[model samples]
Target: MNNYFNSNSVYIEEDFRCRFRMRRYVFERLLHDVQQVNPYFRQKLDRAGRPGFSPHQKVTVALRMMAYGSPADSMDETHGMSESTCLDTLQQFCDTIFQVHKDEYLRKPNQEDLNRLIRKAEDRGFPGMIGSLDCMHWDWKNCPNGWQGGFSGRSRKPTVVLEAVASYDTWIWHAFFGVLGSQNDITVLGRLPFFNNLMEGKAPQLHYYIKNRQYNMGYYLADDIYPKWATLVQAIPNPRNDTEKLFTLH
Candidate 1:
């Protein structure tokens, strides 16, 4: 393998950080953690007298794959690795990251988290709001042949639906993925863990006021497609006038 990550290369450290969305120190720390858990990331000389790619190069390629969502073949020249190896390395990298950090990073909000969210939402006019509920479709370029009809709806291309709840600061509180595009938002919601949490009485309590009226339940802002439940607040459809419409939209 050819190594492209040179310590004294002309590539500015700041430029590399900008491309990966993380500082050099942070990236190195992440690389260290991943390397500690997995030995494959460490460069080695194989029996055939061929050397593997360095850890820094492999990590940079994986990060670029995630940041750009580019095809595996496009990454070969960037780090001088084969296309198939690049894809395999990316898969392994993601799996290792999940194994190492899923508990702390992907966990549901705790009591302290809920309190902070409540305070943040209170400043934004919606007193008891914690986050927004939404669903987005991601195009599945390599969907298997047997699953074409099941995954493709109006898109004419296979897609996977992701239902997520996120706070205003872009922090995700909940996420459910791998749903077929044919399924509606309501169907996805029914299948996700959020509903399970609500049904199991694991949801946190919230207290706030609107126009002197008090509300104790926490709610999420949602689109009109969702139901009119006390826990969900949808945008007003067919506002009476421009002012009301502006308010509803904003």
Candidate 2:
């Protein structure tokens, strides 16, 4: 692990700095919004027990840990903190930051936002693309004892699942995380909040908007693995015949 860390240090540090800077911006935005909508964080900070590390330091350390995937000991050396302090600060930061930001980060996009995205897609060649849906897997170090069953299967290793939606230019619109690794892409997609809204009438306007603008019928692009949903457009089949090859090329 140290060898991996040493070899990758330069690249890791550069990437970590970029993400740390971005996260500071995101955290500040979250802080302002929390003040307006909730006021809970401000109140808690004002009434806290004997103060721990500065919130900004805690947050910076946590973001660096996440972005670099470095162990706490390594983070300590890199950030010039004691190992125990690095570990404790990261744990606290994860707890505090999520508590402050989860609502804003995880909440589904509003109808207006979805409509704007759809319109933007229409402006590009791909019309009615609400977003491009995909799944990504993150390798887990070890399966937790009791939770092993939930996190292991054919892969036989712990993993976390993520589902993301991107625009035509591949800008991620949203990301969902923490589904157990054993689950397949279809299972994860089935459980997504956005998919549920589409099933219910909650996202009806966006559905209707896509239909009106694009194929008259609703459609979205996704990989071959997804079953045909009314709102999803699957890739063309692998080209086996000359006609299929021609179609695929176009």
Candidate 3:
């Protein structure tokens, strides 16, 4: 632990980032937050009155397991913990992080957020654009044999789909995960609840004008696979003229 975290540590910040998949300050902040909320991370004494694992050890083990996909038992020689204990620590760390940070980090956009996103999009030449919508597949390396057929798609591997809408700063305003990988972007959209509020007239209203053409609802920049809905703006697949080329470029 002292090798990277101590004041006179041997490794540099870059080395720490390479090992932890995050900067030292980020890890330290996360550690502080986790320690604040979860008492399980606090060090205690064993039955023989010997000092137990420190919060540092537990957090480091959890991070190593997550960032490197290291097995629970993989830390035995380094951290001197059992596989089951490592698994428990990892689960607790994840739950605590989510519980503590979910509100600010993972929340639906309010009116202010929508307005900011709209302003940014308008400055980029898209008057009513909110963000970009897309789907990606994440491999399920430990997928069950019985569920592999349902999860495997064109990639011929067990996977799940994640649909998200992200803006210029890469802030994900919307995320819908765990869709069958066999599904395409369109199919995933059909099942997404992202539009449910809009359909029910419960979503925030948006108004914008482009060259005297006014629009009431905000839209997303999607790919050609998505349907030609007013709320989605797709680029021209084959631009024929300068005007078309300019539209596609931006």
Q: Identify the candidate with maximal lDDT.
A: 3
Q: How well is each residue in 181-205 modelled by candidate 3, as lDDT tens digits? A: 4455777787777776544544356
Backbone clash tally (model 1):
0
For model 2, name the residue pairs that clash: 220-233
Query: Model 1 RMSD to the real structure?
Result: 4.1
lDDT, candidate 1, 1-250, per-residue tens: 1222356655676776777887778788879988999997898998998987888878888998898887789877766888999988899899999988887669888878889989988887678888899989888889899988888767688888888899988888688884654455777777775676654543467767788898777888999888667777888888999977885976
Candidates by TM-score, descending order? 3, 1, 2
Alpha-carbon TM-score of each model against the true structure = 0.77, 0.62, 0.85
Pairs that clash in candidate 1:
none
* Clash pairs (backbone) in predicted model 3: none
In model 1, the runs with Cα more than 4 Å from the true position are 1-29, 35-52, 71-74, 178-181, 196-203, 241-246
| Residue 110 shift from truth in candidate 3, angstroms | 0.9
Which structure is stronger by TM-score: 1 or 3?
3
* Most accurate candidate by TM-score: 3
Q: Candidate 2 on 186-228: residue-level lDDT in tens?
A: 8787777667754553333444344355344435578888876
Question: Judged by TM-score relative to the true structure, which candidate is superior, 2 or 3?
Answer: 3
Model 3 stretches astray by more than 4 angstroms: 180-182, 197-203
